[model samples]
Target chain A: MDFLSVLQFAFVQRAFLGGCVIAVLCAVLGLFLVLRKMSLIGDGLSHVSFGAVALGLLANMSPLYVALPLVVLASFVILKLTEKGRLYGDAAIGIVSALGIAGGVILASVSRGFNVDLFSYLFGNILSIGNEELALAVALSAVVLVVVAVFYNDLLAVTFDEEYARVSGIKTTRVNMLLMALTAVTVVLAIRVVGIMLISALLILPAATALQLARGFKGALLISALTAVTAVVAGICVSIALDLPAGGAIVAVNLVFFLAALGFKKAAV
Target chain B: MSAVISAEQLSARYNSVDVLQEISFEASAGDYIGVAGPNGAGKTTLIKALLGLVDISGGSVKLFGESLQRFGQWHKVGYLPQRASFSLLFPASVKEIVGLGLLTQKRTPKRLSSGDAALIDAALELLGIGSLRKKLIGELSGGQQQRVLLARALVARPEVLFLDEPAAALDPQIRESFFDTIRALNRDARVTVLLVTHDIGEIGQHATKLLYVDKRVVFYGKFTDFCVSTEMTDFFGTHSQHLICHQHR
Candidate 1:
């Protein structure tokens, strides 16, 4: 099928829509994560969601429903462990990430072998996005974007200089909790599009790419969101056209943009 | 003169080590209180404790006549943390960084009003960086960055300002002018300035009061009084007079 004809399929439309929504959400949240030196947190939370998904599968429940609150809880733990003067800092993330993947593997094996449903979730399957999942993705993305927009200025202050932000009475703790929660929600929502292994790529690459090109925080966020959405669209189209893996293709698109941004930055300088 | 900040028997600890012990002092409105001490003298800890960044082990602090435990009016207080802790790698413009001060005053996510914009503009002009408002923060010089941070702190028109070694990274020329701007803020703006610095001698003349700290209040009194205090002589011995005559760096 041609590009337009391929996109006419319901699954293709769902994949494109879900992927773009998640791209925007991840890019916005990821910028703050990168700025706060917590970029790997997306990786950590994705692994935790993997474990939650395993638990859901074992219990015969909806994996997304089970992973949502579990991921949010994991966010709180990560935030708590990395608070000021916490010796473990990144180590805590490492432990949780390793444990999560291990737990997911153990549970998956104990459940009498990895099923196709679990495998599809492990790898990306753009063809599997149902209408209900599409609606949920759109709704959740709206929530993340609205919360971020409402607190953009405050979040920026906290991200750059948290100590100074605290003194400014920005309620650094509450703002941080909110950021972590939003990150958790985004990670959960992103799983259906990029799956476990490639989720962090979506969260980090676009923001990193945009930072290379923008001089202001607002501009960087705007560019990152655009970059992410474009990557998702192009990646999906390329995936459909070439019969390639959607997650890897999307990440490949993101990498290309980052390199292009680097060239742009160098030429401008 | 009402005390804008008053601490009685203040104590603090970090990583299970007592950094401050039974320290007490008061900063009245419009007063320039210069805090001086050796490295690890709890100078930063003292400021942090007062700023509620540190956990107070004992004693009490009152700001603007309210107990520190109930001191929620952060809009009236501004703090500039140690310069070394600041990172300019993030992409925020001078205007946006300074505008963060106004966002602190907001309890909700409302739009920035014209009045807030005017205040940010005034702060930039006051710091003589209105031209650089659109410049990226990371691209500025150390002095310019410090001024931008000061503008961030001052944009809200805080009645009391706490600065923790704000000039520690600036060159001597810039440091002198930094204090000059601070003096103007205190004198013209009628704001209380509590600045922690390594330059005891330079601040002696500009500051109305000097607080010599060594884990506790070694001395807290008028600058002239501290100059002539037997406590000053006793703490540094014969070098006390020489300490007062330190060469400007």
Candidate 2:
């Protein structure tokens, strides 16, 4: 097919649209994740999502719906464990992620063979976006973005100083819970494009790249979203031209963006 | 004058270990109370108790004649914790950081009111860093950062300000200037101040009310009274009393 004709395919159009929406969601939500130094929490939760997806594939159910509530529950558990268990963040993430990956392995072994659906979740297939998935991703992105915008100042306060935020009556607990909940939801949405395994990197990469290039918090956020969108579109184009898988290609593009950002930062300094 | 804050027989426990016990004190509006104690003396605990942060296992705290439990006017209170830690890599400018004090007082999704913006500007000017508003918060020196943090707390135009070990790691010159600024705030703005610190000597000149705590109220009254009362030497030792004579900015 010609270059223009490839873009005309219905599945290709859906992939690009869904990719854009989910990129915005991941970049925006990931800004705080990277800033607060909880990037691995994303990694841990996404692994938990891997097990949940495994469960769905085994039961002949839609992995997306199944992974949704399960991932949300895991997010709460991770938060409570880190706060009260005397264990550090990495420890908590490690324990939960180990449980998730092992469980997935055990389940897959029992099932005797990995199905096409299960394999899709591991590496992801951007060309498989259905209309419903696209709609859900767009709606959830809007919701997450609204929460970020509305609680921007409060989030900044809690992120900067939890004690001061608490004394200042910022409802820190609620704000934090909201952020965790939004992250869990956004992680699930991002999995369709980046896969459960590499989803956290998708969430964090854009934010880190933006931090290298932008001077202000607001500037970083805006630039991160722009970078994510550009990378998603460019990744899709490269994937089409090279006849490669879009998800892996998108991550490749993200790495390139990160390296370029580092160069620009050094040059500016 | 009526008391703005009254803690009666107050107590606090951490991990079932008693940190403060049956402590009581009162301060009226415009009072500059310096909270002094040795390490692990429950000085921070006492501040936390008044701020309604620590659990009040016994007694009560009253703010503006209302019990702390029922007191919903948290917006009028400002707090700066010990060690003022924040990421130097964070992209927040000085303006954004200071604006958070007032922003936390506001409801979500609300824009800064014109009055709030004015207060922020005034606070920056008050702390003598209005020109540095555009600078990254992490780029400033420790003392400058302290002033910026002070400006943050001041932006709320708080009726009662609580500072915990604010000058802990600052240079001697900066520490003196920090207290000087506090004195000015107390003298000019009528903002009631509660400074929790270990430097008994440095804070002596600035404080109107002195609260000497060691898990209990060792002495609570005028700074002059604490210096003269035998309880001062008893609680702090003869050296503290002798040092009091030479303690001045």
* TM-scores of all predicted structures: 0.96, 0.94
Candidate 1 on A1-269: residue-level lDDT in tens?
A: 57888778888888988889889999999999888878889899999989989999999998999999998998888888777537464786787788889889889889975566787787767668899988998998898888888888788888988888878777889999999999999998888878888888998999999889887888999999999999999998888889899988999999999999999989998
Model 2, B183-228: lDDT tens per residue?
A: 8878888889999988887777788878889999888888777767
lDDT of 2 by residue, A1-269 (tens): 78899999999999999999889888887888787788887788889888888888888788889988988888888788877787887898898888888888788878866566677898888898898898888888888888889888888888887777777777777887787899899888888897877888788889989988776778888989998999899999999999998998898899899999999989988
Q: Which 10 consecutive residues of model 1 chain B have the lowest summed lDDT?
A: B240-249
**Highest TM-score model number:** 1
**Residue B175 lDDT, candidate 2, scale 0-100:** 75
* Residue A2 lDDT (model 2): 86
Can you tell me which runs of candidate 2 are displaced by over 4 Å?
Answer: B54-59, B245-249
